[model samples]
Target: MHTPLAVEHGANLKQYNTFGLPSNAQALVRITSESDVRRVVDDPALGLAPKFILGGGSNLVLTQDVRACVLKVEVMGRRVLETRDDAWIIEVGAGESWHETVQWTLDNGLPGLENMALIPGTVGAAPVQNIGAYGIELKDRFESLDAVDLITGRSVTLHSQHCAFGYRDSIFKRHLAGKGVITRVRLRLPRPWQPVLGYLELERKIAETGITAPDARQIFDWVCGIRSVKLPDPAVIGNAGSFFKNPVVTPEQCRDIINRDPEIVHYPMPDGTFKLAAGWMIDACGWKGKSIGRAGVYEKQALVLVNRGGASGAEVVTLAKAIQESVYGRFGIRLEPEPVVV
Candidate 1:
């Protein structure tokens, strides 16, 4: 039986990620079609332990040689299948770059995805984190997704409710995280657009420009512009954008932190918890631009940890642990990582 597969081991994974850290893979495979995905999974020649789904490779950290086969999804397609009076449901292949899908939505004049612009990674991985930026998340626009279960080789459509979305989390990440690979994702985008200026940065951007009712394309461009300017292009600095997720704490904890430091930036989580910006916490703790050996915190952003040069995965983990420990010690709040360290 003919099959598509990668013919290499100990391949340098540096270029595979935005982080540009040196790592190795035991095996690598790119599946261009839905059948190809199954074929690679069912390959007897390659003893299957488990497999890793490689998407945009932006929101992950390669800390060691992959002990599992890496299946790089190449399935790419996009279509506008349904239009409501105020919205359209767009079906996008899981392998499509999430940003590409966002761009497509804007190019077609869809409005919902404008706030989530410039987040790196594939459409499939978006659900993995229930990815968000500015003020919108994948869950906000999520209609459904189809994924192939590795164990049963069955396709299942998981609706947004089934995805179990939280702050940068989902069922695909929590329960069935490594169980299967997503093939398609459907999104319902707004047509009769409403501007979301809840995020401080976004609101500030629009306020500074004095633009009212900015269209989806302008909002997308503004987000891209802000991110490109504020965030160091990973191609140059070697980093996974935003290394830690914002900590959501109880309302009591929020008040306590506020009492301790009145200027602490905190947002109320939907579940009566207070969400604190991990970047602000880290920056306040003085970790920005701080380097531990070869691994250093990004100078521009406190939330991002960088591989200055010759840093190993273990080293990054160690530094992150230190930051976590330090943050907890200072504020009595635990910091959680945003990237998948695999």
Candidate 2:
């Protein structure tokens, strides 16, 4: 016998999203497995209706009440799937907390994910965003993922090439967006576990501590400490972390900006492009600690937009737009928001 789908109508989503923005889903179903997703796809009413896949809600901005059926991915599991000579493969449920998973890997003697520690979201959502921090990205550690097609209710496994990962993006965010549900994720933590210390912050930590050969746990702790000091806790102060993506510009554009402002923060990419700091641009445009309605720029980090009290999604968008305009007007570079505005 098949389990009955337990659907909740008019579900309040304020608590689901990290931003704490108020929004309601017309219908919400907690998806626990791939079979649950298939059932949703097979249902007569829901199958035809528009669907919205919701994970940890860390990288989302709900602008209004959702009319579509919301599939809240709640599947849970974590284990070392394979222990290869060169790498360890760990499979995780889509719903598992990203930071917790990173900790779990380290606890289990795995250390490749230390650089991405403290990232707020689910394991499933990581691939969709190709989430990165410090010096490592999700793509670097990714193995493959299992997803259920919304239309056919068919399970599919995709590898790195299929994911089409770019800076904070993947196929899941593009052509396959809202068309399927990621059920499980597999991570490849390479052996030999060399610490990624190229990032300025990590380098600074090394300089300060005089511990050039820090372990994975130490790196994880440092990353968490750095993030805690830079970002506001969602429980205490609602935020979606890094409101905008650091814009990539040509060398000519970088030089132009550099000529105009001698102290602009930027970094060279492997592709020969320059990644300009969005937060620095916003700060240069004088947006730090500024407010629009109940939404405000975080004082410590201009890239993050925070809810002063009970800020609405529209207020957040408005503030983001204002910041974008100001930064563009000054830097001649458009800042792209990292969050998916629903």
Candidate 3:
């Protein structure tokens, strides 16, 4: 016998992911119980076997055959930990789809996380990337989360401060990308949220009527509407969404590029740095919708590299390299891909 850890193969990964990118795993382990992790980790068939934790696969772009054993976190549970007329605390399993979790808050009439509506990925991966959009970040309402250390098989609690969130990055992303798997995350939300109103699109939305403040649900709906326009429906198109992070450069460096071409677009960061829109750069470099075989940059959002159909991981990587070369050659800034290429 191949043994339990070595026996089963799961669903076609092409459909499990929102990206719809064709990919597969040779051996799959769906982990429902935390204790099952220890058994899988120690399985003789998995002796020195490489391990990976998969959530919604919304943020990851699989680029090749995964020789490693893939663990699908199926842990599911959600509860209202503490609540009152004004304060609400909710805890959710990391396996919960993030978009669903956001919807749950709105349905319950609580007033946080609405601004983060429709972000694709699991709750566990949210903190890993410190997921943000519009004008709010997960860290803003974050309470804490439990993680099972793969090496020690011990569950540890991590507070918001311990997360060390900064611009689409956190502790799990930086140091424990593969070593720690999150079990659950708790978030504290207030009945009345402090409206986030700095994002340009958001500001323009509320600015239309010259409103002073917009409510959480209103802002949440707006964010969802905006993202829908910017990013393609993964069901209709196979894409990993944003292919690169908006490049952040010092003011001096930005000035050099702006001087070279006044048409260059950029946003000023709070840290006195300039966030150059990667999509704008790609489009400016004439790479938007540029196709090399079946892989290409999204026509609407240049930052997203899409698989038109019948595309392989190798083709995606090749297209990305070409885009990088073009952007770097024209602007002297190298575009970095956001997807975890496996």
Best by lDDT: 2
Q: Cα lDDT of all candidates, in order?
A: 0.82, 0.95, 0.81
Clashes of each: 0, 0, 0
Error of 3 at 148 (Å): 1.1
Root-mean-square deviation per candidate: 1.7, 0.6, 2.7
Ranking by lDDT: 2, 1, 3
Question: Where does the lowest 10-residue lDDT sum fall in candidate 2?
Answer: 324-333
Q: Give the per-residue lDDT of model 2 (tens digit) for 213-292.
A: 99999999999999999999999999999989999999999999999999999999999999999999999999999999
Q: Give stretches of model 1 more than 4 Å off.
A: 1-7
Q: Over 4 Å off in model 3, which ranges?
A: 1-7, 84-87, 209-212
- By descending TM-score, how would the candidates be arranged? 2, 1, 3
Give the C-alpha miss distance for residue 304 in model 1, angstroms.
Answer: 1.1
Worst 10 residues of 3 by lDDT: 1-10
Deviation in Å, model 1, residue 8 alpha carbon: 3.9
Residue 217, candidate 3: Cα error in Å is 1.4
